[model samples]
Target: MKINGEVTTGLGKAAYFLSQEFYSLEFERNLGFVPFPGTLNVVVSDDYLDEINEIKNNCQNLIKPDEGFGAVKYIPAKLCDEINGAIVFPAKTTHEENYLEFIAENKLRDQMNLKDGDIVSLEF
Candidate 1:
């Protein structure tokens, strides 16, 4: 079975972890990363990253427009007893605003009908 951990802070976006069974290839892959147990990491496919990055970049408070999409910094791996595991984080992450102001000066929001309280949801 896969082991998913609690969300860690400062990793940008939601960063759940794989613990105990983390770095176990089979476990991490459940979260969309290609398990590379040898390196205690997973390979995030380009398609996957792009889709995820887009949403993160748009989420006003999650990632600021200035900071752009938060980059993947490092996958933290820890050794327990004799096992090694890692954690992943965004290379750059900044909070833009508490609220997502979709209505830009160019009527972008109006064109898309994305006004306040309008939820632009996504699916993985």
Candidate 2:
């Protein structure tokens, strides 16, 4: 499956959670790499809401967080048909339904030269 969306800025909160030792260890164990200390936020159009929900419902790769943190589920995905990454869905998030969070081994924005409003594709 594939989904496309425009790059957007996040609430600047993901880095703290992502940088935690417990989460980093879990990511390394499950995904083979510790994610970059942040996430790439993508805002998909309403047209894909159903598909997004479907993906979230079917996702099986779950990362259980330590105390005081929420769990997250992810599915391996490719960013812009090139970079390796995953689409992560947090069990608790302030984001709306249309927002998608992506994590990779490196900073995706820098690696892809992406800026807010840039359109990108994710292939699973």
Candidate 3:
């Protein structure tokens, strides 16, 4: 499946959650590597929001909270053709359903040289 969106800024809080050892380990185990300490926020285009919702509905193998932390759902994704990543939906997120976060082994924004308002493509 493929999804397209515009790059956007986040609340700068992903590091607090993603940097936790519990979550990092779980992410590493699930995704085959420890993700960078942050996520890349993508605001779904209106034309593709419904498609993203459908993918979320059918996606399986979500990562659950260890104990105290919030839960998160994930769908495997690749960004910009070369960046291996995943679309992450946090149970306790500040973002709306139209917004999704991408987590990867490397810093996607830096690696891809993206900025807010830039167009991004995701292959899931």
| Tens-place lDDT digits, model 2, residues 1-124 | 7878999999989999999998889889988899999999999889998888988998888988889999999988899988888889999999999999999999988888899999999887
Residue pairs in candidate 3 whose N, alpha carbon or C atoms collide under 3 angstroms: none
The model with the greatest TM-score is 2
TM-score of 2: 0.96
Model 1: residues with Cα > 4 Å off, grouped in runs: 1-12, 15-68, 94-124
| Alpha-carbon RMSD of each model | 18.8, 0.9, 1.4
Model 2 residue runs over 4 Å out of place are none
Residue 101, candidate 1: Cα error in Å is 29
Distance from true location, Cα of 52 in model 3, Å: 1.7
Better of 2 and 3 by lDDT: 2
Off by over 4 Å in 3: none
- The per-model lDDT (C-alpha) reads 0.29, 0.91, 0.86
Quote model 1's TM-score.
Answer: 0.21
Task: Please identify which of the two predictions, 1 or 3, would achieve the higher TM-score against the true structure.
Answer: 3
| Ranked candidates, highest TM-score first | 2, 3, 1
